[model samples]
Target: MTHDEIWRALDALAAENGLSASGLARKAGLDATAFNPSKRIGADGRARWPSTESLAKVLTATSTGMADFAALVTGMAAALPRGSRGPAARRIPLIGLAQAGGEGYFDDGGYPVGGSWDEISVPEVGDPNAYALEISGESMEPVFRDGDIVIVSPGAPIRRGDRVVVRTEKGEVMAKELKRQSARRIDLRSLNPAHPDYAFDLTEITWMHRIVWGSQ
Candidate 1:
């Protein structure tokens, strides 16, 4: 990919992930400005090449494999058809609690039996890895209310302060902001004061992922 293309992609990714290039670099354990736009342009005004080490650090920071990184660099960032941009227009089949008992988590056939689904519209997020979920309760309000549609990007990494959807081994699904994570437990801050803040044992978690964009 050209330097401009890489710079643009990195800029978009940084914005979507709520991070600056320097912040992303820090997260990736690299020197600040490793992926800065300024650094992408040489002193002679030519395109500067990205170092392999810098790319490796970024991949690790984003928890993305080389192949996935390659796909983004190739301008095939998992996007859907143009007309399917709205949340109400693109929905994935999600089996609810009533149907979840015998269903597997996701790949094991435990979630839902079919692809029947609804549609939601979320703006500015073009990744096809993004999908929508309807808020079922008022646990997260002001920011997210009951019936609000949330677009989730399973490809996004969990980060401090990011709103997330968490599934417990007991078959409970909840939404909250991530405060911290460790090998043993996760701390969650409730968006609604009426609901108690969550401190879940990590071992009991079935899955935890971020909400990329949401529309009320």
Candidate 2:
């Protein structure tokens, strides 16, 4: 698996358990900073990977089987348990990132609205307002490729370090990791190092939705 995929899976696992990366490491009996973003890259600018022992500890602490963890890493829905599937495949709205910034695709709250969107069928999410966005640029590369589809949940609670799709009042739509959110400003970290990070005042943001899943 790719380095990005592995880290993303770990992040997903932690989020699934309602914990942060550091919290997951703590639960696994590892150093609290073991899974922090800063730890993912070495001081020399090389990628750092988690040890097998650490992975073992995390799986044991969370009671997660390798198969389930594999599902998260590969973004393969079939690898997950059949019983965990939604009642049926549901068609959700799908639109490209470029089109997303256009006028009619989303409402003020970031919910998919209008007839301009295409649709795709996937396992249902709890949010009826959930929709999918197709990646189109290199700004979020490696973690998300040009054609990758990310499921966005407007109703989900966003936390620090979560991947999110944000729309600006000026009609700019971009995806980045949430670094911090204050009453006045929101900070975002770019997934691609080639891109610049963002810090915008709360008023500059129209809506921000948490990225719940990725079709890697």
Candidate 3:
């Protein structure tokens, strides 16, 4: 088989086993970088092959046989289990980060309630009332980048040290890491390195919601 095809089969097998390629290698008692892309090509520019011992260990670790590997190679294997699927078919409102700071996008309870939102479908959702906001700029980089979607659970508890979405009575919305909270004030660390840590009076914050998931 061609190198690309073999690598694709290996990736598929890793997902079927619910582990990443590096994770699979580690589970098989090999170096974590064994299946990494950097090692997929040789210094002489020839296609690299997985060592036979590595293959044997991987198969034994996963309780998989050579026939299963062959099935993957030939595209004859059963689909990965639905529970391990990435996203479900349920839909939720998707709002842009820029517009999220505007008025009328949220209700008093801090849940998405207005009609200005677009929509997106996820593979599954634990919170039926959750909504999504797409990051718009490089401001939240390192932790979240442009176009990344964060699923906000308005009903979820907001605790100290959790990443959160906070709205204010003045029509401002912010996503940041919660540093502390008290009856009188809220302190936060910005995800964007360019931004400074912030402190706000509890009276100024209209609502707060903890982010439960994200599509990276």
Candidate 4:
């Protein structure tokens, strides 16, 4: 690709991802000014070309694959939209479970709301993907505790041995490591054995799925 095209792609990608040139450079583990507009201007006032090494550094730091980078450099307009998915995931304010029943902590319907909640960002689960709930009790302690934001990705196929957040129809929400699942039942090990091992029938579970990630 032409040097101008490469530089422009870098600039556009950085902006779309909410990064400054320096920020994108640092994210990719390169010299802060590696893709700066000034760096592209030569002593003779012509634009300098981005070297292969610099391009490789940018690719590595952003975890962008080569074919995608090539598509970006080639002036394909589609690359712009793909960058939106890079870091813009769904996140919402989280409220501790203990405080959930307190004044102005959540809506009357139990949806989280108000000034007491802290914003917790997480990856968006596309297509019937579910939401998140903050952990509140010590019943599932050591692995998950009060105030932890648990990102639940329901509708994503669950595999055996994945750690999950399970909500029972009886209104108990708990985190457990999955051991096995059958059409009629789910076998799980509690994070806190003080609670005992769980083996619930599918009818008893209101919702059950993996915890993709979490934050303290």
Find the candidate with the highest TM-score and give its number: 2
For lDDT, candidate 2 versus 4, the one ahead is 2
If the candidates were sorted by their lDDT against the true structure, best first, what order would they fall in? 2, 3, 4, 1
Candidate 3 weakest ten by summed lDDT: 75-84
Candidate 2: segments with Cα more than 4 A from true spot:
1-83, 86-88
Candidate 3 or 4, higher TM-score?
3
Task: Flag regions of model 1 displaced more than 4 Å.
Answer: 1-91, 94-105, 108-113, 119-129
lDDT of each: 0.63, 0.85, 0.78, 0.65
lDDT of model 2 at residue 162?
Answer: 73
- TM-score order, best first, reads 2, 3, 1, 4
TM-score per candidate, in order? 0.53, 0.66, 0.60, 0.47
Q: 85-204 in candidate 4: lDDT tens per residue?
A: 356466655555444335664333334456666766644434233346678778778877776776555544465655677666666666788888999999998888788888999988
In candidate 4, which residue pairs get closer than 3 Å at backbone N, Cα or C atoms, i.e. clash?
A: 28-61
lDDT (C-alpha) at residue 38 in model 4: 84
Write one digit per residue (lDDT tens) for candidate 3, span 117-205.
89988756556678989988887778889999988877655656667888887888888989999889999899988988889999999
Question: On TM-score, who's better, 1 or 3?
Answer: 3
Displacement of residue 51 (Cα, Å) in model 2 is: 13
Candidate 3 wrong stretches, greater than 4 Å: 1-87
Worst 10 residues of 2 by lDDT: 75-84
Better of 2 and 4 by TM-score: 2
